[model samples]
Target: MHFLNRGRKLVRTAIALAATIALAGGGVTATADRASAAPVTPSPIAQAGTAAVKGSAKDGYQVYSRTSEAIRYTRTYDGIRVYGGDLIVRLKNGKVTGTSVGLAKPLSLSTKPSVTALSARAKATSAFRGKITSSGTPELFVDASDGTGKLAWETVISGWQPDGQTPSRLHVITDALTGAVRGSFDEIESVSGTGNSIYSGPVAIETTANDTGFSLTDPVRGGGYTCDMGNRTSGTCAVFTDDDNLWGTGANADRASAAVDAHFGAATTFDYFKNVHGRDGIFGTGVGVPSRVHYGSAYVNAFWDGAQMTYGDGSGNAKPLVALDVAGHEMSHGVTEHVVPGGLTYAGEPGGLNEATSDIFGSMVEFYANSTADAGDYDIGEKIDIRGTGAPLRYMYDPAKDGSSHGCWSTTTKNVDVHYSSGVANHFFFDLAEGTGVTAYGTSPLCGSAAPVAGVGREKASAIWFRALSNYFISSTTYAQARGYTLSAAADLYGFCGTEYKAVQASWTAVNVAGDDFCSAGNDFTLALSAPSVAVDPGTSGTVTVATTAINGDPEPITFTAGVVPAGVTVSFDPATVTAGEPTTVTVTADPGTPRSSAPVTITATAPSVTRAVSLAVSVNSSAGCTGTNGDDVAIPDNTTVTSTITIADCAVTPSSTASVEVHIVHTYIGDLVITLLAPDGTAYVLHNRAGGGTDNINQTYTVNLSAEAPNGPWVLQVRDAASADIGKIDSWSLSL
Candidate 1:
């Protein structure tokens, strides 16, 4: 089956054709003239991955960013890059400080493709029946959505859709070596509509007056033009021409009647983005989008195929699908594709985001036009009687009104059709712009346990979404990530931790999207350790500074505690307790007979209702000598996992020998830490799993049996901080074999 056919079925099934009626009265007649068109030019192929890193850069690895302070890297093996393999390194003015990786392990994969590119293309074409207008060379891609990577083939096939009027651009991904189709989606975004001379009503449209006469082409705005397909399946469409300057009679009886709405929609959508968001045009390059009307016999849909917009005549040719929102929705698809490269994957959560993006701008365009004929509202496709009951196709205020649409987010959201899944984001945008409960637009209800949200105004909300779409979003972005990026965008446009940022957070939460509200002004206190980690040798002592600052409500006393001390180690706080804005010193002492190993310690501070933790490292050097240490400072952000590796070289041990590890960590709330030791052979031993309760710091040594294992390879000590609010780092560690 075709990818978008499912969505068409949903719309057709839900549509109640009992209330079909004429939208506007009168018809504008116009004569059509044949015009020559330039040959179609293929779109330039995008480079598969980021520019190759030079100078000692390994194959399948690329640098994501670089600055005097630090550099970020990602893995791209054999031309197929990891989707979320981002590694960030911190530097102190040019000196190396610390490093953190997005992936759990290094990327390693075979570069050879077992299936040929021709075979991949053939599979795509066979899956969907359509004339091939354009095809791109299949490229190797890695499926890394689940943290692990798998190689696959990504192919693009475009041509006339099986529905005829709706063009198709399908992206089919197949397992490179197995020839198994992993997933597929249509790139062209579309919406079904009904017939009738639909107009936003009396809007000014730009026209070009040539030597012959005036045409339905706008020379003042990106050279966009509206043409009549003449109800033919094949051949060039003629541009609408008129001897008089005025066009369209607000009725679908004449071919030029629908052109008025189509032309006006294009202009209004362009102005909305340009004036409100500072964007130049749909592609942000002042490029025009051609509009083709009257496509196919009894057609009932409109779509945007990458470069242009096409509308079909409604059932019985009595209605043209050139409604304002429909036109704006179609063109906005082009904008999204150009704004976010790869166009949001066109399936799953990303696909829902893509569709929701168009719906958002389409509604904005209607508001921008503000024509009395079709008053601006949150209702989508309301003017078009596609549902036959005079009801809109989807309601942003309550998506469930359409039956199939999801009013809120859930785990199964991505499994639904993009159009239905889009309801979650659409509702989010509405709530963000208009708040919950009664409003000028409509009443919005909260999802799950979300609190009622206050509107940030459509103007500011649209700006935040546009900024995120243009600058922050990626093809595989999830709804949770959308919340983060939008928050980031709001921060960039307004200010961090401001009202705008708070509204963005509240809006997403109202749609049941779980995210951190870091900008919230409710935090009572801030906790930090003077250093990321500390190192202490056997028979020696190390001290770290624990600082607490007042925020929101303060001046409360904070009690200090210790967590997971080594067998031969003891930890104590100099001031044990202090009020907010005071600093305390944590002293960790190791016994002279301490075993040669690494131990992780945690320090926690607790007030009336606020508690935080940091991690520290304690190492006991082997009296026999052969140990390595890493003192790099790693930042463990809240609710994230981070790893620090210590390599022990030139060390050999017997096969049946036991190994000792000394780990030191400086973090708040050791109870939230999960530390593990990963050997070279992939054997992992859990050192600590929130074992310290509410105590803080990990200054301990662990002894593990290394029998039947090799002891001369890189060992990794992984530390994960699994809760919110508390954060710390892996200070240093030593290994003895």
Candidate 2:
């Protein structure tokens, strides 16, 4: 079938892209798209290892016509690439029937009944239903595959409802064959399944609450639990525990379920952060941040307001996105706040880094959880379905692969959407921690590169980076600072010249951060000014600018600030800005508070302090022309021809012809430029003149060929100047062959 796939282009081009290095140190196999071959022959079935059973044409029609819960199954036995086909079935009466493949109206085949047939309707029903051992609870064992047409990733369903509905309960059992917990014995019920949370229920609540230090209470259906919201002055508002007599039909019960989901989410998030980055909690210490689920009435989003995390029920389209990754992401903000207490004020590079930290950790958390109900993957926010497109928020393999993300950066990288903008650093982290080729980590083919990691694992790298952020990097940090701090951290943990340090350097380099030169060379100047931090809220626009230091020999004191702010805000920079030096402070102010308080920005400097010209001029002079007389020749025979001349350039020049000559010239270029001379006899002489000369003389020269008697004609001399010519030059030429 000609099914169209939109993600083909980006997925294919992900591997061959070029990467730039950081000044300082640093550093799509498309198998699924192939066409399938046509089936050669179609015959009857033999032994049934896994029966490829086909239903009759009437059965197939009934599958579409019947309202029963029986689901229809279709399998492309060869591969998923083929288009149309038919079904052949054998009935209980030993009657054979064939159905033509047609979407509108299928053709049916008549079958000839056999004399020896099984006459029993009871036996027919028994074939579809597998043997069941446990019967009481909400548990059943079928061909596990029979449960869903084929295998499927499990999804938990939990929540609350009215009094008549069944109370939520637990169910767990192992598959008879695989021993996997494919079917659950527990069954729970609520009033409305729409409001039910997947991560709630007994097991999740108990396990999650125990994992976190928080305590759990009875399923307070419709009751708002009381918890301290920290300081009220800073907008840290707390909710009072109240069991309202009148609540949404079963929203309160569902909200309780949401609370359990939140708890489980917190547990997974905490474990991921600690296990991955060695961070104790959001605060690096053992301080756990409180997450209140079902914050307001259908408040679609989940956010961390500088203090604690809050989750809200989504509208009709989406569910409450308290998934592990999302919870980890929101909680990461609190971690960032604790780490860099100054907030996202220090905009630009640092701000971008801060935002990216959350995304990176979020992906890491998903990777750690590794739950089938919510399998770990690089795709961000897929379970939440925030976009309703069945895709994800951002793709790590190719951020732009989903068409909603930025993918990579351009000169105007700062102008993209913040969600997309976060891609720049995300790409850096991926390429840095992982190298340029395909990785063999057994991960989904999403990340095209074969090299999952360059030198060390992401765990070590993240650990070092976290240490760097907590110990070395400040609130107003820049990409440069991050590179350095990370390198330093890696160095401290793995040794200065270890693979981890090199990988860290390489990753930043790939992301286009010129690490070696992020800082001014030779100039030891510190700027209190750093990259501004940012926060992107649902319906608000905020802007922040980061000021740059003036280079001593900067043709002019150029005021640097990012311009052409995105739609959300009218972001502006200052001097409208330049802080001349110490004591001269340049302030980057955001106008009219944003819908969300924090928004991220990344500022980089294209110009640096020190300037040194690396241009050199070279010159050389030797034999101008050669003259052969009878004085040196014992016999100047009749047809005998003699010639000699030395031609030289500013750099070393070799005589190319049988006749030798050196012509004076300048080698104002770097590297080796070739000199060639062709003799009249069609013979050519060549030499490679290496370019570096301290005294501005011939570094190396050679007289190619010498002949007492040579053909007498104007010998052609060709000088092929070397490509890399920054330190030397080429001048006059003379030749005789």
Candidate 3:
């Protein structure tokens, strides 16, 4: 999940102008830009600091338009680009208007890797088992998601899942120096569900009539076809073909009975996304996804394995995991991954969002189909008695009815399993679409002190969520962010201060998610950081920008200062001050020979009436290495492969030396990756195959005995993505000889 790039224009209001005028303080003057017809002067604020801005004046910051009225400035530290460090300055006809900062403070840390690329790969391998398909070279990354940053190695491992046929792509994050696994997540999204001796009963399905008679394939809908796994574990399954135009008898007694239900489910799901959301297909392309039924003997689950959908038979081969909602649920996983960047990070709050996204759409698909055999409802997996007690797998109307799922948000919400954590969002969606108390779906109880929420209707609710998922929300997004993004989506579709937007806020409140009321204060002044934290090497320095933006108020002067500084580190600001609606640079310097450690530094921007403080993660390290990286972000176009070259000129390493190669790639689907390293002599070493199945990004190192090849020439790194419909990029790479 990532924030989608938008090019909409912002509407300025009189309140914003007044706020700017009121906030301007000493040494700050308000001016108007006659050309742009907006304020051109700085708002009220004071500045204090001694650190002079260093570096070439022309090389300081580069501005690019974000929205029509906002221009973003990229941040750097001692010449090194700061990841996630950027500032957005809103302007109207070249006048200072408002600003939004991405970085909390400058980065001050060590730029060294203590762990070898080979060691990082080994650690990743141990954590990710199964058939090793593709293993990418590890690259150094600044981990700043927690408001503190650290140098970590990210490796992408792809291959067949433990079940063999199911593809698995696993992203492993390791401590760069310690080689300890920090975290990992699978890219494939799956949900447990099932079928029957034709439990769905007779349903209308579209099939292709071929020379071999009617086949269980929908030629009309992206050539989608269903095959039989034959209760086996490996190899390609055969597509179901019948001598006649008719399919299975509505009974488990016939082998094709389950296929009928599976086939119908796929068709309904495809139609749901296409007709309801205007999506072309699962991938938003006119491509059909393959569905395989009869997966393992008594497997009792279904999953969207990154590339295709697979279903299992229940105990006694009596239950096939292919219900209407289950089919929609599994297929929606594909839509979510393809729609969102890195597909919601597959863990924590994002993971729950992923699951809930599927549930929401799955239920919607069921409703769209309106199958009499399995009516659309808030309950999931109710038709399939997976629990043997006629109870559904989950209750979206009142998630807590399941005993483990939470209906409201809490501090511990992220700690629960993704399936349960999803309850919070699921309940919120239900309340938003149908309201509280008695309704068509059922009675939805409010959580905590939240008031009753009015319904926005399912159509509007789904549109709002789909818009948010596609346009807002990025990887590492928290529930609070979801609330904001949903509101933004509603604003885009309905109105900024409209009923839909307010209902979006109230729905989240009903789920106990707070602070979303910020939307209510339209045109209010605000502060934000592009990145919450940053990392720097010892003896080196980094820079961050502070920005102040007015939603609907006058630009004011804002004072900037460092709240906390480590003993060995000093913080300074360029110009030592700033006015609201303008960006100021903050530089952090670490003394030479400083001890390596992590520190949390806070940067505060204060005005006469309001003050905001943001946290920064500073890490100092002692590890060192020789590395090379791609200066610009390379785009890997769909269905095409790209290469990035890392030239190593006069290296002192001998031909017989064992060299470690670290490659870092940021992509959505690791299963499509095939990475190779070419020595100076044109000798190619396969570092990774298309192994990771559906996992996001590749970060791992490969160690090879380059004793036979010279290390002084230009080495080329090649990357190929076998499949289409998804794309990614090679972030950077390093060669430690």
Candidate 4:
């Protein structure tokens, strides 16, 4: 947004020329056809003129004099309609020589010299009007024929559509014309690089030749300088001029690839405007414009000098500041100048507003451009390498990073240096466009807890600011005025009492720029602090933790109140009460916060002094347990011996059930022991137990008997413990059949 740049000065001379374009005062109108007046008759004036006037003047006058109040016209001599100024007949060697006249005014002849000039003047005056319309370029076009539809001149006429940054005027001029087009040039303004370098320049039929550094094969200097793909050097550096023999030394970069990079970057910027912002070029109309790069000696700035964009390679400490953002910034100045009269002048708040306006739109263009090579960020001049310390020119998020002088603005902001003073407004834009929040526009990551606009988000904030910029805020908008304009715009765009309107008011307050009472009455600027919202996973089970914090600006402490915790979830906070200036984390936990399982838990911090609510995402996790059954347990008697029947549990999921269980006993003595299996209900079948004593412990014979009336299912076998040492451990056994 800074106006003083090295390259800008070099092109300073051209500013006056462009500014001299008459600020016409008319609108667009329809032109009438005069094709019938194509032939015959000559005027004494035409005969008095040079032999070059081979055609008939009467017919030409008739053809050219077709009038239309709405149309702008130029000059007409003996009816030969032309776009430029007056016409005159000069005598050379006693013969009619030729004609010449000023393009700004027209000429003709009457019976007397003074009368003829006066008549021509009157006719010119009557035929010409100052009004300009969007006929072709974003410029002021004159009514060459006094609003009549006629060929004003053979000069080339081009058009440009301003991208709303400035007044969209059609550029009209009268000059010697040639090429395929005849009598009048009628091609629409060609837009290259879309919005990158919006201009009306030559439509080169062929592409520019690639510079392979073929000229560098032979060098006058003994020392060789390498031209790598990315390396850039000042075009004024000795090596640049000596090795490459390029004229610009010291201030410009002479890399072989710079031209391509600059061109592509400009093209990308243009495309960004056209594709993203819906602009034809720099101006909304497709105006062919030149994108001059590598300008001047070690120049460290870029600017749109009323007509074209100029870039300069910075000093040793910096590189060219012609990045996409810089390009957008310069082009935006053109837009500003078009829309706001005297926008370029530096004065008071309007000046600061002007600067900030450029920065804001520059950033917007970057955001809109959204190039892969350079993703849009709210940072300015990050790639320029000015400090050689990796600090951008300005930080929209935290302008204070540069210095306090350039940070947030107050009433006294106008007192600071223009560069630093600019920050206050820049910061306001940042705050207004992006609320103080955790995230901005999705990609704009925020610093810890410095949320923009307190309660609202960046998207709404940007919309409010954009509307304010285009609608309510005038060229001389102050911080207070900005607040009001944005509020009104928000209400209009989002509806009265809508979240957006309230958010806009709150955002202005957060930035300390609250507006009048009318807009502020319904808007709340107080921080609406609440706990974090609930986040969930897909499946399984888990817990969600909710943390609470009192909104910083809240007048007093708030009592933490929990909202509906998810099923299988729990909620709590580190410190239930949130004291002023002390933010508390209200933790909401889920017993089994399973994966993909989530619920919304709102934690309201309410008090007579203040009220705030924060939502936490209570979620479950599924990554906790293994896929199958972990382990199993079984029990068997020691002394008694008997075959035990047991069924193992399968690995299938059993939500809230226990595994099957079984018990068995064995006999260790020589005796007639019978083992009978019985169900828990006392049902049994056959019983059989046998023991042969080989080591004198016991000798027994077991008989297998089947009861005819026995019901057989799962049964138990009972046996007695024979050994003395194992007697206490082995409880008694019984057979049920």
**TM-scores, in order shown?**
0.61, 0.39, 0.63, 0.37
Model 2 CA deviation exceeding 4 Å by range = 1-254, 274-278, 344-347, 437-455, 517-737
Cα lDDT, all candidates: 0.67, 0.39, 0.66, 0.38
Q: Which ten residues in a row have the lowest lDDT in candidate 3?
A: 16-25
Specify the highest-lDDT model's number. 1
Tell me how far candidate 4 lies from the true structure as C-alpha RMSD in angstroms.
40.1
RMSD of each: 18.0, 33.9, 17.0, 40.1
TM-score of 3: 0.63
Per-residue CA lDDT of model 2 for 1-737, tens digit only, reads: 11115422111001111000000000001111111355532222211001123222232211211012111122232232111122222222222221111111111222222211121111111111223222222222121121112111122223221222222232332222222222221221101113323432232322111222223321211111222223111244343232322111212343444444554556556656676666665554554455555444444555554444556555541366566667766666566655443222222344456667777777777667666566666666666666656666776656666664444444434423345556666666666554544554212122232223363655675677666655444433545556766765676578764677767766666555544423232442223222223322223322322222332333323334443333334434333333333112222233332221222333332224532211111111122233221111121122222233332222122332333344322333323445555555557666544333211212222455545324444454445544442222222243432
Off by over 4 Å in 4: 1-256, 271-279, 316-318, 437-463, 517-737
In Å, residue 117's CA in model 4 sits off its true spot by 29
Model 2 alpha-carbon miss at residue 178, Å: 72
**Tens-digit lDDT string for candidate 4 (295-334):** 5545454545456554554564135545656666665655
Residue 518 error for model 3, in Å?
A: 4.0
Query: Model 3 misses residue 530 by how many Å?
Result: 4.6
Q: Where in model 1 is the C-alpha error above 4 Å?
A: 1-106, 129-137, 143-148, 158-160, 193-197, 519-737
Tens digit per residue, CA lDDT, model 1, 1-737? 21223242111111100111001011112122112255543111011111111111333434443445444444455545555444333444544333332232234567588889898887666555457788888877776543345677788887877566667778877667767565666766677756453554455776665555577766655777788889875689898887766676666776676777777777777777788887776766676668888888888887776677777788788777776777677777777765543456566788889889988988888888777777778898987787667888889988888887888899768756778789999999999899998888778989878889999898998999987776556555678768867886787688877889888888888889976345334546655553345555668876656656555554788999989877788889878998876667777787875655566787788888777776766655543334656655577788788887766566443422346677766565788999898888889888888755444446565677665566567888888888887766665576666
Kindly give the number of clashing pairs for every candidate.
Answer: 43, 70, 62, 132
| Candidate numbers, best TM-score first, in rank order | 3, 1, 2, 4
Q: What lDDT tens digits, residue by residue, belong to model 3 across residues 659-699?
A: 56776666766778888988878999888888655555665
Candidate 3: global Cα-lDDT? 0.66
